[model samples]
Target: MRISALAAEAGLPVATVKYYLREGLLQPGTATSATQASYDEHHLRRLRLVRALTGPVGLSVQQARSVLQLVDEPGDDLYSTLGRAVGALPPDGAEPAGADDPYPRARAALEALGQVYDPEFAAVAQLEGALAAADDAGMPITPERLARYGSAAADLAAYDLERMPPEPHAAVEYTVLGTALYEPVLLALRRLAHQDAAVRRLGREA
Candidate 1:
């Protein structure tokens, strides 16, 4: 396929695709002519992944490029690498999580929760602290409850990746699926926690 066809298939603009090629995010397709490059399904797939990372995830092109490099590198452990990368991100509700300063938003969220539900808030804080300590010890996110999350997530992500016709498109599909899936799962867990607390309170009164 030509560049235009690749861009259309990926639902990206031609210039954006060219920009990715220039930035080394997307490898060049075959050089059909001095001015024309022919792309294949692999290029289309990569472009989709790049868009998802840079678009919704708010990853800078450089950050996405580094991640892509890690994913593509042979013999790299994908799960461990991804765990490290995500653990390095600031706690939830933090803005510009990269800055060295404390995450005021996350702090505020905790403070608000602490006001209304001290025990629950304390539990969440302990969990967060434990996860941080584990990360510092070079452990993956091994909280069994948290690790069990992958069971629900893996199938959805696999389905999305499989939906992409060409095998190479799996990369792009996985990126978008992760971005789309995690948020709802987190929210659902929060709701479940609240429900559990309510049920426990009712049982105590009974």
Candidate 2:
């Protein structure tokens, strides 16, 4: 397949495909002549991944590149590779809290749930930031509530990991893609569940 065919198969424009090639987001196809090259299924698959990153996943080109880099060169340690991939996700832009930090609260909550995590992990910092904000808003998450949420999240994580690919690169791609694509579905389900619970428990007629 030529670049045109590849782009057509990917549902992207030829110019966009060339742009990706130029940006190193898509690898150049095999050279067949002075200016012609042929692409294969691997190229098509990568193009789709690139589209997902830049389109629905809404990552910048650089962020997408970082993720692809991780998939390309996954290290020996699976934990580290996955950790870096998760860290590449867009954050809430909350810097670490200071002396009055709510990080201790987050750490304590995780400890109570028997969750072993890196203190320096992006999600740990995200949790701390969220806790601090909630405290400031006078709606702090109680330890009991944290435990409930943590339990559900743990189950969800286990469910996700159960279906992870065995190969290293495929595993990394699966984790990253699953996190990005399915997060919105999870959030929507949560909101819908909230509505259903409200209706069921509050005697609301709807």
Candidate 3:
């Protein structure tokens, strides 16, 4: 296909596609003439992945290029690549543990989560502290329970990441479909939980 067709198929403007080519996000196509270039399906797939990484995720062009490099590498692990990218996002709030804090509980929780989940230390710490704070505020989950939950969560996350297809186009579609469907699917789960709780409460009373 020609460059124009590739741009259309990828749902990006022609100039955006050209810019990606110039930025090395998309590999150069075969030159058919002095001004015309012919792109193939691989280029189209790469362009779509770049669009998703940079658009919805807000990765900078350079960051998107880095991600594309990982995706293109023959032996690169996509799960690790995505974990690193997610870990690079800004930390939520104050440092996980205060410099002068005497207690080691928060630090310990974070370290435990990091050992179990392999996320960045700070990310794990932030998650742990959030769970702890929620429990302290009587959200019904204790630190020990949260640790077990984290283990289960890690297993589910790894499974989902493994299920993603290796091809760039397939990856892009997987992300799009996940974003589109996950919220409603989760809402359905929440509704099921409500119904189950109501039924169990009535059964116990009976």
Model 1 off-target regions past 4 Å? 74-79, 85-181, 184-206
lDDT of 3 by residue, 62-161 (tens): 8677656654552445545555444433335334454454224555565667854433434555565565677688885566885896687678668767
lDDT of 1 by residue, 83-174 (tens): 43443222332123344534333344344434332222223344445555656898746435443654555565567555544333234344
Global lDDT scores for all candidate models: 0.60, 0.88, 0.66
For model 3, the stretches where C-alpha displacement exceeds 4 angstroms are 74-83, 89-107, 110-122, 125-141, 144-148, 161-206
| Candidate 3 local lDDT, residue 70 | 55
TM-score-best of 1 and 3: 3
Tell me, by lDDT, which candidate is best. Answer: 2
lDDT of 2 by residue, 1-206 (tens): 99899999999999999999999999889999999999999999999999999988989999999999999999899889898898888665356556554367667777888988556677887877778789999999988888899888989999999999999999999999999899999999999999999988998656
Query: How many residue pairs clash per model?
Result: 0, 0, 0
Q: After superposition, how far is residue 190 of candidate 3 from its true place, in Å?
A: 5.7
The estimated TM-scores of all candidates read: 0.51, 0.92, 0.62
The global Cα lDDT (0 to 1) of model 2 is: 0.88
Q: Which window of 10 residues has the lowest lDDT sum in candidate 3? A: 87-96
Better of 1 and 3 by lDDT: 3
Q: After superposition, how far is residue 157 of candidate 2 from its true place, in Å?
A: 0.7
